[model samples]
Target: MGKRNITDEEIGLIKAMLKRGMRNDEAHFHFNRQDRLISPGRIAQIKSGKYGGDVAIANDTALDQFLAESQQRSGAPAKAARLSGPDWGETFEADGGGGFRVRGGETDTVECKLSFRMNPNRFAEVVKSIAGMANNKGGMIPFRGT
Candidate 1:
């Protein structure tokens, strides 16, 4: 298929999902109930770097924009096994540190984290991962020093 991009409607849905301010699990419950194309697992995988699509990200100060970058960076890959990759299972600890992902209205994935406080190595690894993703045609937006 051609380079897939998030559509206007999908953007609305994603923004709506973002607006709710819920964790992946909670968001999944809502999105699944609505029977949308993107799943909760897709959301997590997208965030964690398990999945990515072709799209140049836009710069913005909005949480959704920043978060989209974060998910693309630290989150798992789409092919990579996720915290809840399978369809039957769907339960995740919302450390906020756990990194949440979302992809829609755009092909790129987004990852976000809210850690209590991590050491240098963990932070560095996250950076490496983000850079890797960016180089691989993906993007990242890990939030540290919060």
Candidate 2:
């Protein structure tokens, strides 16, 4: 065979995988294991809408169910809030992996603290951030750098 094109069914699975946060290389490996040859770059192009294919829509019901089930199995929340606005709290410095860097920033949705004190006022502010997030459709607080 000279070449084989991806079918609608494969496109659906690929779309589902992408939506589930699977990287292009990961998806390529997944399909290759099943004897379906696909390049990571091609997958990326498909995901980015650069190529034309019958990919599943974002609101696919089956994709949603797959994501929810995967999250449950992984013991993670189905949804998470992103940190918005500016960074707060003290300056933070740490390094992980092969690189190290230091930065201190806060966002509207996040309130970082260098340390937790027994001061009632500080505690109240922390609680206020939590309550604010809860009331404002949820957000994230890294909490004393972790």
Candidate 3:
């Protein structure tokens, strides 16, 4: 079967997801279901500003609703798991299958990274983010493996 073209609405949602610190692969995972497949490269294009310039970002409310509905469709819990204290560690360790969703995307106390390589630029960015978080009550910097 031919790959389905992502709609404007989906593009908007993808923008919102990217804004919320979701990586391209993560956003792609949300849209690329078994019945409707979209190329990962499309998501990379969107992330790199090569696509979806005309589309408006979906609001957090819309994104949240979409996530809830997606969870329901997948038979997962309607509510995303909250990351806090020891529970956060337990959640991560327990969900060996990956793809677990966290409630309340990125916040002042939480930052998400796609990965952490040895490159100086990326390292510096991560350090700056950590310092910023440290300045304000400390925070978690979760790396979503690619």
Q: Distance (Å) between predicted and true CA of 9, model 3?
A: 0.5
Among the numbered candidates, top TM-score falls to 3
* TM-score, model 3 to reference: 0.49
Residues forming the 10-long window of minimal summed lDDT in candidate 3 = 89-98
Off by over 4 Å in 1: 1-22, 27-35, 53-60, 64-146
Question: Global lDDT of each model?
Answer: 0.43, 0.55, 0.71
lDDT by residue for model 2 (1-146), tens: 24446655566767777887876754553354335556667788778766545455545676567556655553433443443345322223454564323232333334555456559866887777788668545556555434
On residues 15-127, what C-alpha lDDT tens digit does candidate 3 reach at each position? 99999998676677678766887888899888777777778889999999998887666553533355667876543322346555434344445566656776976688878
Error (Å) of candidate 2 at residue 45 is 1.3
Model 2 residue runs over 4 Å out of place are: 1-4, 33-36, 58-146
Which candidate has the top score in lDDT? 3
Candidate 2, lDDT over the whole model = 0.55
For every model shown, what is its TM-score relative to the native structure?
0.23, 0.34, 0.49
Candidate 1 accuracy as lDDT: 0.43
Which scores higher on lDDT, 1 or 2? 2
